[model samples]
Target chain A: MQDDANNPEKKVISDEEIKKIAQLSMLNLNQDELEMLKTDFGNTLKLFETLEKKDVDSVEVSYESSKISQPRRNDEVLHDNKTQKQQNADTSPYFNKKTGYFDVPPVIETE
Target chain B: MLHKLSLKQLHDGLKNKDFTSKELTGHYLDRIAKHDVNLNSFISVTSEHALAQAQEADKIIQRGEQTGMLTGIPIAQKDIFCTKGIKTTCCSKILAEFTPPYDATVIKKYQENNSIMIGKTNMDEFAMGGSNENSYFGLCANPWDLTRVPGGSSGGSASAVAARLCPGATGTDTGGSIRQPASFCGISGIKPTYGRISRYGMIAFASSLDQAGPMAPSAEDLAIMLQAMAGKDSQDMTSANIEVPNYLSYINESLKGKKVGLPKEFFQDGLDDKIRSKIEDAIEVLKQQGVEFVEISLPNSVLAVPTYYIIGPCEASSNLARYDGVRYGYRTNNPKNLESLYKDSRAEGFGDEVKRRILIGTYALSSGYYDAYYQKAQKIRKVIKEDFDKAFEKVDLILGPTTPSFAYKIGAMTKDPVKMYLGDIFTIPANLAGLPGMSIPVGFSNNMPIGMQLIGKAFAEPEMLNMAHIYQQNTDWHTQIPEKYTT
Candidate 1:
């Protein structure tokens, strides 16, 4: 919206691309939702077109703030206490008390 | 009568044996019970639990043990913080039935201080929207005008405090959540310097920018609440190991020689005329106290909203990928397989705005667009921070209108997400820079409260609070209550 040159490379995304994005996001969007997202993304992405005008070629990415992270703690294998484990076990349907392991449906499916 | 008492008065009352913690807690609970029907500010009102905690706090005071400013005080926690065995919905349907097995570090700190946990406040689900409308629990209203929204995602906390539902509440800011709502609802709130408070057990949305702080009636109360809430934690590595100063000690410090910058960019075209006039009046108050205001520029200020949306959604998409229906939170009733479970559960679990952010984030991080969107946004984020870095070189802190205008009507801005994102313009830059920022009640505009934001250099929270305290002393804005709720 600024200048034609400022908007030279507008990232145009397609509806098919929206479906793939929903899938990658693990969200099952219905057709209408997908259609809405196409327009939504188009409008939202236009905000970024403004970013291209700034000459930030030499600027480094800040994954976070300027503060340096605290030093890592040493790895220690401290087991959870019994009551705490029981409290956690109550949250899951598949916790195996006898085996001390949580069970899940087998990853391999035979059709 | 009790609800109107300042926090220090409540503490003194508890200490002098004038009223027990149970009585104080009961008074607040009763207020929330009666008044909250108009605001919907709470998701879970833990009345029984709160009273029980108040009883315990009474015992601690009875024993003559050590105590702090929050001892026996009742405080509301934003539902984003996981309270063990309490249904901690971040006002999302996905977590509507989800209760955590552990307390957030901020909650634990308050508990250690023997502060009573009144209830869990409502918020924009997963801290996604600029308004509380995005919540599954329903929209939270401004106490001043029930038809309008309390600017969110900390809307519930702000509204609750404004209506005297609770004395103080904890709110997390990713973009403008805490400050904006505080602005809208005519209360006070601060988002401490990044890592000033721990995030352990506080549900993440854009983990990089999310930091917790306090919302209260006044800046002095914020100093007390922040003292309890801040410090480093082993559970949150991003929490700064730096020492938290005695905020209250520094709160009463002089404002005579301190310099504050009024960014010309923030005061430019977008701001409402009334808000600008109020901020100028606030400037006069500060100037009378010998504080000087310099007109400065943050040239890239317009770019903050765009930069924050990209980074916020990207990290949110990744952080939120954890809710795949396996362990906790909502799961689809019957699923054919793991993939369907993940898809169906997430689709049904999240709201429209949340889904939009996840999709945008996913699309940006996917194979080809990562560099163009995510990486480019990160680079621009650095430029925004450097802009602040340059400004701080000349001024002690920055001052501006907390929102472009005061709170809009509930359904007014909900249809347009990009426009709603732009509304966060003034508050987003501070989150980007990892600086400490706060909003205090300045004056009223069109019968709605206006907030003035004070952003200090990183770790300059004491100065910010101190300066806010000075403004509050000179004006009665912070002490005013909504007329309809006054009775």
Candidate 2:
């Protein structure tokens, strides 16, 4: 097992890429945090780059819990406990009692 | 004396009228009150709730008909499990005020067995970091030395058990969250085979990799607690339908003629000499008990860390996308629109480590890079799993150091996230393979405890526990308490 864990070369994540990924992740990072992440992700990319050395062409993708051979249950509305459902909604901080939906800031904006 | 008692000892005391559950619970509560200010092990100490549960457990003992081993016993839970009507925060600000209407199957199991819930242990927020420094609650200290970390994200649970704040605690392991901390704290913890424990109501980290298990002062206590914890649940579709084995029946048995594989990859040049020597000493002890050690090779284990980081965060990024602030978690103040509600809420709520993983995950799973990063990592994961499968065919168990090194000072390795990622090389492979693994206190280096990891085949927790119990019977390492924690 060769330990090349600290090799920091061959892949440079650009600024536009960082902003795009953060947008996709739905996180708003400030300028300083984005700068730090660029460095961090650069190292992460390099760390993962070592995996390219392994000849994995013939290997299949194996999930961690592949051993759990469960039968697929019929997908239907299983919960009939409406009171329990309401209680669940009530546990949230922004649940609206009268509207019967979650409360959030208005989505559509118009002048 | 109460602090030193195992779970079995505590159960016996209650059954024989030697001590009331309230008194026992109070003993641990008093310890938490006195010591947790220094340890920062608990995010929220449920004293009133714990006392009430203790009263109920005491009543059940008085009835004395349907009581089980866990009845009248006090234990702590990692904040990740959702407790019905009680605040289950996962130690993240995102869900700091959020309560669930339904209890996690694991929590429901403990409640059903009449066990007392003492508190919610702190962790690396959302179970992200290798050290507890990433916790939103505060720095969770190793009881042995307050300045050093307890090797997280189960740092709080490990510290509580090792410091004797509680007789036992539950910890979830995605990538060595349980075993690494148990190693650092000089206690016993196990991550049972994946799917062996239900993950329902456990706030997701990496859904496929996460599994909950028990941590305690001794392997026998772990066996007892794990038995109560393990089972199939319909709520968790991934939870194994196989009947839970009687773990106790597997332990207290001889280890004569048992074959254990010492993976060559685990002892490569990178392992600290002091830690390596300690693992060798553990092997000598097992050898005396008629356990045969064979050197085996798992070639692809070298890539485990790199492979896991990609897969874990990719899953985490997808899983954490649920915290959009419109539903149950923290909502940002004065949101201008829905997009601001999602972005601003997450930005204000999640910690740095959590954000780091999410960013990496999103990038890996992105359109053009998916095949290069995420798919490549998954294929490598298969390579690592196959290595374990082959090793198991040659031997019944794989034994090695639980961590590459002993606990480092806080802030020492956090700056270099890659170095911190490499620290998990030994523990990551077991999680990658979904095999059952555990850490037992083997010896010490520089007054810090060393842990030897034992990885068993999938669904082979009984054999793993039997080996650990037999080793614990021969060694007093598990019984040694920190000098500071001793009254």
Candidate 3:
């Protein structure tokens, strides 16, 4: 790829993009983080500008592991140890005893 | 007497009855106790277990029993591996008190061979971050200079080896966790082809990219560890069925006509001049030894860090999801309900970088955005892999600097995650390609060490070892440890 200056189609990282990244990254950043990310993100995107000229089309992709699959293990019983109380206990601090399920604030905001 | 012997030297000494296994294990345990308080390379040192194993090894050797290549050697395992009765936190608060009930495949293999497990080393939480600074236990200092970082998530393993805390240690590489840290700390480490070592019980980072390998004092020693560590296992489906070659013997053979490629892209920009010069000088020495070098190109090489960000975090987010306040780990002190429990547990359990990557990964893999980012990056990942494959067809191995620069001061890139992520820039491509690669100390920039990486074809680890072994024979960088580390 050519440098960002040379690639006309490449968009300059903007505040909007930063917001999108923040949302994805689940970051609770202040204005300082957004501003700092502006430079950091730009540098990262700019480094990628080196990819524009190289033809990666002809290269063959590798499966990090070999393609051949292994046979499944026999259905043999292994050590199984757990009590009913252990399974049914209000195991999670997050678990609500009344509802018997996880509780979270609603993600959607009301108008 | 305690610090100078390499794994090979110590192994030979034990075999010859020059020293008992108890004596050797005691020596290492004593050194770790002495210097490790300042260096902080270990999370838990297994003194009691180590001595017991060492005594057993001595008995077996005296009984004329046969043992594997790693017999009687002391090795520190990265905290990511599950060690029964030992803390295996992956350096996160979530599993701080959790001891695994079973051993990881690699740990089991070591145990079977009677290799002494000296301790568990520290790492970046969930194997995130470039420097050991992300570790919740605290930052691990470079053995060479106390103020600087020993490049991380495998920082403890690298630091431990550099400081002679143990003969060698095992480290898992997701991106450049093993190689970059090994480079910065001036040690030898290899991230073998994925599946060369089983990942059955390793704390998952990026499952596709995660690999367990050895960090040692020399390429030849690394070979011995690799021989014991590499093989297929019924427990891990991803383990390869390829024949495990005798790596130590293979690396010592002639490399008269081997073709080496110097990728032009790795040397381009943002690289330290001193590191570049040292790598060039090393290449010159290799050329004199009759190893040929040719200029080559890996297009889309710059996309390494970006692709890694998407894939590694995406995998990490998924892998770490199991740590939800339920199964055998940290739970919030007080929570009104389950939602708060999950949120508070994670927020308190994970470090800043781990949280950041989890959020990033969760976002990328979430609905409505998977196509634009995750899928696109996977396609780009394929392109990157292909690029390496094509280059390997024409060259026996690819050589470059492990990181673009040397280890930076602690907190140098704390505010800049992107900059920290770039430390593994040159190293990540091999992970994406599923190829074997290694970092050997090339030379020092200022006082900190710089590393040169040797990348080989998929499953061509024997070739990579040969290249690193050949270079070490011609240079003294691998032999030079920090002055302060020696007693």
What stretches of model 1 exceed 4 Å from their correct place? A1-11, A77-86, A93-111
Task: Give a tens-digit lDDT track for model 3, residues A1-111.
Answer: 324433334445678766776554434456765565456555545544444444544545443434555667778854343443344344434457687555554545446
What does candidate 1's lDDT look like per residue over B18-84, in tens digits?
A: 9999999998988888999879999989999999999999998898887777889999999999999
Residue-level lDDT of model 2, residues B1-487, one tens digit each, is: 7898888889899998899999999999999999999999998889999899999999888987767888888899999999877888888999899878889989999988889999999999999888899987887999988889999999999999999999999999999999999999999999999998899999999998999999998889998999888988888888888899898898988999999999999998889999999899999999999999899999988888988899999999999999988888889999999999999999999998899999999999999999899989888888788889898898989999999988889888887788898888999999988889999999887789999999998999999999999999999999989998887
Residue-level error in angstroms, candidate 2, position B405: 0.8
Name the TM-score of candidate 2.
Answer: 0.97
Point to the candidate with the largest lDDT: 2
Candidate 2 residue runs with Cα over 4 Å from true position: A1-11, A72-78
Model 1: per-residue Cα lDDT over A1-111, one tens digit each: 433212324436787788889889999989888877676677788877788788888987768875665877678855467887688767665467688765444568877
Expressed between 0 and 1, the share of native interface contacts present in candidate 1 is: 0.58
| Interface RMSD after interface superposition, each candidate | 3.2, 1.6, 5.6
Which pairs clash in the backbone of model 1? none
Location of the lowest summed lDDT over 10 successive residues in candidate 3 chain B = B334-343
Ranking by TM-score: 2, 1, 3
Error in Å for residue B391 of model 1? 0.9
Name the regions of candidate 3 deviating beyond 4 angstroms: A1-111
Ranking by lDDT: 2, 1, 3
